[model samples]
Target: MGNHVETLRWNGSAIEMIDQRILPHRIEYIACDSAQSVAKAIRDMVVRGAPAIGVAAAYGVALEAILRKNEASNVFSTSLEEGFKALAASRPTAVNLFWALDRMRKLWETHQAKNQPELADIFLGTAHEILEEDIRINRAMGEYGASLLPDGSRVLTHCNAGALATAGHGTALGVFRSAVEAGKRISVFADETRPFLQGARLTAWEMVQENIPVTLITDNMSGHLMSRGEIDAVVVGTDRVAANGDVANKIGTYMVAVLAKRHNIPFYVACPLSTIDLSLATGEEIPIEERPVDEIKGFRDCHWAPEGVSIRNPAFDVTPAELVTALITEKGIVDNTTLTAGELADFVKKNQ
Candidate 1:
């Protein structure tokens, strides 16, 4: 009910985001004014999640346009395009960000000739709609996702897929939360997603606040735990979902999916349809960002190495479609064996 750290919040003038690095311990706000800064914030994980970044990028571009008082249409348009490119390049993989940007661009171009002063308002309004729609989709996803789980059965999840991760209650975690509140016996085992630790710090924190039972385990320890017959289902969020159902999530998520497949466990990808990229026909086309080497070598803030130890830190990894059991969207938990943009558009229509 209170202000959540993981979601995006606007306080009239500026956009505020939670500094996730010090999360579960510190509550710091990163105030963003320009599109470049906002893009960097997302690239650095100051504000994350596909939908969140998309909405933020839309507003960031609007903010950039607003700051440019020079009404020279060419100059102002160029500035806006630059801002969009900045935000677009930040994540490279999350289709939601690009989709939201394109939506804003289309609306702006459509109204640019007739309405000038209202452009900012239109941008803000479109962003609000996007955020609201995401909440609805996630809520439906929760309900649809709940149906996937047997009543009074425990569920296992990886990463932070809850309220903090998006505009409201998260995708995969959305279903998990609804199921628990409905008096279904559920326990969540969160993989301590390493390098970034979205699981240990963000997901675990949310679970604790909600008073949901959670067992935190190291990312590598997931297979061991499941092998010991400790897991029932594996639900995780996606940075992007390929047409073939291959999921790009946090670096270790592929491993979780692999283990789930090995254990014959049900592995589900819970996400908004916006995260789906129909253009990229295959997962191999998705670019995986290899983060700073320091991420894999040492923890944030506190240094562990002597002087210079090279570290290879890849921000995300891809899980092939072969391992995914199902794709959970607002419309329903459907298998994307033959995926299409129509499925996404239909999903939106169904939610409405």
Candidate 2:
């Protein structure tokens, strides 16, 4: 079998990101040469998924450094700050985006004494490191999460949290990959996340590429499947995990979690430490990104909704800590009891 797909790569001169907007049918890469272009790509969903977006944002800073390699010290510093802000603003729900940009910002602040050329090299190196570390961290998460599954486990996943959603192996899907690698038989049920269809277009497509068994279901079909005892577990990736372990994932994730609980099936959230936001005390505090009305009206230029209907398209919804079975992280797993008391911060502190 071939190696896992790379979601994005720093190609010496630019960040080459797989165009997520038109996948399965067409495989193309977007070459981002400037921080502005990278920001646009993130906002436009050319490259998405919390971890992937974070990695792309780090590369955005590197692109800024490369562009300002010949500028004066003050000019370079000012432009760098602007680049960081732009990348941070590209998406608000994912803490990883802010976390990655802040890391780059701190690196620049610490190395202000270096010349533009040196700074450019340092920024590029750091971006590459971030990208590589994401894959490593995801695999570590995969190992821990995979251990939670039994033989012949059937997992229900939301959105496109496969290789397309991360730097390499995915968060939720990574767990499935690890279990399969460990010689456990496993399959997946992917929800066709509406208004985006990331699950249908990306997740299912990715599973086929990896030779993982997958079943496609509409967003509303989850509870029905669970009611019939078809789903053994529900595992999904989050854009942000609140201090209390309340998960903010794709819009339908809360429903899936609720159904999983009703069916007495384990609902797990696979995430990295970077995706956890200690600043947010609860999921209620996590910002929900609302998309343009066009997305709700149609997909990729196909209009189906009535021309005058209203739409509320919140990109994500928060699943309270009470609904979570466990929080799977690169550090370790935190049970729902620990998560509910809002003690995840304490767990992270001790582990960090």
What's the true lDDT of residue 111 in model 2?
Answer: 90
User: What is candidate 2's lDDT per residue for 1-352, written digit by digit as tens?
Assistant: 1185568977779999989898879888989987889999999999999999999999999999999899987898788888888888899998999998888888988998888999899989999999889989989899999999999998999998878889988899989988999999999999999989999999999888878899999999989988888899999999998887889999999989888888899999998999989998889999999998898998877899998899899999999988999988888888975544547878888876
Candidate 2 residue 238 C-alpha distance from true site, Å: 0.3
lDDT of 1: 0.79
Off by over 4 Å in 2: 1-4, 340-342
Please give the CA lDDT of all the candidate structures: 0.79, 0.89
User: 86, model 2: CA deviation in Å?
Assistant: 1.2
* Candidate 1 C-alpha lDDT tens digits along 1-352: 1244547777787778878778889888888887898999988988777777777888787777766535777777788888988988898767788888888889977887644457767777777788787777788888888888887666777778777777888887888887776777788998888878889998889888888798898888888888999889998888887766678987888888889889999888998878877677678888888877767666877767667656677778899887888898886777754555466445545664
C-alpha RMSD (angstroms) for model 1: 2.5
List, in order, the clash count of every candidate structure. Answer: 2, 0
